[model samples]
Target: MIDIKNLHKSYHMGKNSLHVLKGINFSVSEGEMVSIMGSSGSGKSTLLNILGILDEADEGTYTLDGTLIKNLNEKVAARYRNQFLGFIFQSFNLINYKSALDNVSMPLYYQGVKRNVRTEKAMHYLEKVGLADWASHLPNELSGGQKQRVAIARALASDPKLLLADEPTGALDTKTSYEVMELIQGINDEGKTILIVTHEDDIAHMTKRIVNLKDGLIIDDSKVTQVRAKAENYV
Candidate 1:
């Protein structure tokens, strides 16, 4: 579902340039669940940004689904992002004042979905994430895990082809993290292509494949035996 070749990115400060991604190459197939792992300065975040079309690569190419992603204007980029990608951030990124239902429906609203239809879809996804009863609660009113669940619901409300999660379990406790991973695993089992960026080894092990990055290049890309998160124990 994602293709990248010779991907390179750099940030310039004064006379020096910091190259974050250097000659990166990888492909993620439909229905695959993958994690990008790296330490600080590894350029994994930069890679994720490029894949999300939030930023452009200085050199190389990225193709999402079937369309080439390069130098698009904001309007076109936004259209592709809405139609082809979904995002889950560690921060949740939900509006403080909006209820969970409203937060989940925000993307659909941006896509011009009718109010009733979007509401129905939002409820469906909230239910999928086991947050149906918390729909009326605002972000501030929910627990950390619940807020992330709302974010996941918002991302899925679009039914996008790919899901990009950045440090999805970063802020939660171990049990909560497993709970969230369990939810994510179920999502992947249903055939949603997922790419996660995480520094935690245990978290990466939950995914079907891990791509290790260092100094702006992929050092290792291998499929591993998936370790299912035992959220049931925590519950």
Candidate 2:
């Protein structure tokens, strides 16, 4: 679903260039769950942002589902991102004033979906994530785990082919993080590719494959372990 080659990104820090990513390459197949694991300053987030198309790469080629990313104009990139990808962030990124239902409906609203259709679809996803009862509540009213669940629901409401998550479990406790992982696994089982960037080992273990990044390059790309349903742990 995603093909990346020789990706490079740099930031200016007081006349010095901070080269975060240098020649990273990888491909994600449909329905695959992958993890990019690294410590701070390892460029994992830069890679994720590039993959998510939230940021552009300074040097490299990225093709999503087939179309070359660099070739796209801003408007086309936005539409492609909205249509094919969903994002979950560490901050939850929920509108402070919007109810859970409204937050989940935001993506569809941007897609030009009508109020009624988007509302129904958003509720369907919220129910799938076990947040049907919390729809009327605001983000501040929900627990950390509940807020993350709502974010996941919102990400899935668009029926995206890929989900990009950056440190999704950072704000939650261990137990809550595990529960969030379970929810992510269930979503992957339904055939959406998932790519998550996290520093937590347990969270990395939840993915089918782990790619270790260091100094802006992939040093290890291995199947650490197969992912299992939370009901029956992996053998």
Please name the candidate that would achieve the greatest TM-score relative to the true structure: 1
For each candidate in turn, the TM-score is 0.98, 0.94
**lDDT (Cα atoms) of all candidates against the true structure:** 0.96, 0.89
**lDDT per residue (tens digit) for residues 68-166 in model 2:** 888678888899899988999998999989999999999999999999999999999999999999899999999998999999999998989889998
In model 2, the worst 10-residue window by lDDT is: 226-235
List ranges where model 2 is wrong by over 4 Å. 227-235
Pairs that collide in candidate 1 are none
Cα displacement (Å) at residue 144, model 2: 0.6
Residue-wise C-alpha lDDT for candidate 1, range 1-235, written one tens digit per residue: 8999999899999999999999999999999999999999999988998999899999999999989999899999999999999999999999999999999999999999999999999999999999999999989999999999999999999999999999999999999999999999999999999999999999999999999999999999999999999977874
Report the number of backbone clashes for model 2. Answer: 0
Task: Spell out the clash pairs found in candidate 2.
Answer: none
